[model samples]
Target: MRVEQQPGFVLHARPYRETSLLVECLTRDHGRIGVVARGVRNERARLQRAQLEPFQRLELDLLLKGELATLRGAEPSGAVMRLTGDAGLAGLYLNELVVRLTGRQDPNPDLFAHYERTLRRMAGGEPLAWTLRRFERDMLDALGYALQLDIDANSGEPLDPSIRYVYDPESGASPGRPGDPHGLRGADLLALAEDRSPDVAGLSSLRRMMRQVIAFHLGGGELRAWRVLR
Candidate 1:
């Protein structure tokens, strides 16, 4: 399939054989795609090297062949973020999440929009924690593994604001009964599910619960960018 001027964002890119590059891009229509940018390493190549960075919108031209496509040309579709300080690190974390979680060539328009919004928020120096958490939840939902947040997973009732609960990665939130593992307070879990800015204590518990859930889906491997951000 040949595509002309498709809107997309570069997820990742690395040097390939000789002067080519293996680029992964997320598109609005085609979802995630892998392309081999031939001769991109040449100094005289028409493609602007700067346009290939993460979070920069681009219009890509390519011809698909099996799993990999041949990039014919590329041009920046909008202004690229010059992320600095903490914001830059947060942007990297977001990119890493997309690279790891999203399947290649799978279309998810909602996820694509959420990702663009997350990048814009990060670049604007907004609070990264809240945005990251919200995006994580949205991403999980888009991938058909949305977390159970409104009611107790075991009890099948609305979460109690006054009681504590255990947030199980496999089963979601449950009453924090005796001998329950991975339990957080019902209030705190509810706060996180609602995307509210919780207090320090609440944030701590929410973070632990989110990390467990994410790690379980990621095959127990930790996000490397998390360490850098910390």
Candidate 2:
């Protein structure tokens, strides 16, 4: 089937055979898609680049068969969002996450919308930590692993800002267990839960909590872009 003028972004791309490019794209309606952009590297082509680069929204035409699709045409769908410094790195990290978590041809339009909004937020110079935390929470929520940050897991009550709680990926937040070395303040978790920007300590706690949740799902596979941010 020939899919025409789909909204998407190039999540990743690389050189293909002598004159083509292998491109991985996240489409608004089609989820993560891999396309063979044939002849993109050839001198006669207008794109000139071997592959469409990351961080740009695009309208794409794809020829679908089975696993890999043939790229018929591609053009910028909207203005390219220019992200620099931490924002740029963050964008790469997001792309990697979507690439890893989503399957080809699965429609995840809401997640696609979330991705676009996050890029806009990042490009607008929103604080990296705050932006990252929110994105992590939303991404996890979309994937059905959303953290129970607003309430207690054991008591089933709204979290009090002053209390401390242990976070279990499967069980959500609960009053700190005896001998628990690591826990988050209800203030901090509630701030995260409400999507409020956190203080330095709270942000740190959020980072740790998000890392734990994401790592649990990933089964300890490392996030390479995360290391670059360090």
* RMSD to the hidden true structure, all candidates: 1.9, 1.8
Q: What is the lDDT of residue 133 in candidate 1?
A: 79
For candidate 2, the 10 contiguous residues with the lowest summed lDDT are: 45-54
Candidate 2 residue pairs in clash (backbone atoms < 3 Å): none
The best candidate by TM-score is: 2
Off by over 4 Å in 1: 177-182
Query: Model 1 over residues 1-230: C-alpha lDDT tens digits?
Result: 89999988888899999998999998888889999988878899887666688878889998987988889988888778767888778778877888888788898998889888888888887777777777888888988889988798877999998787877778888777775555677777677678777777666777778888888889999899889876
Which stretches of candidate 2 lie above 4 Å from their native place? 177-181
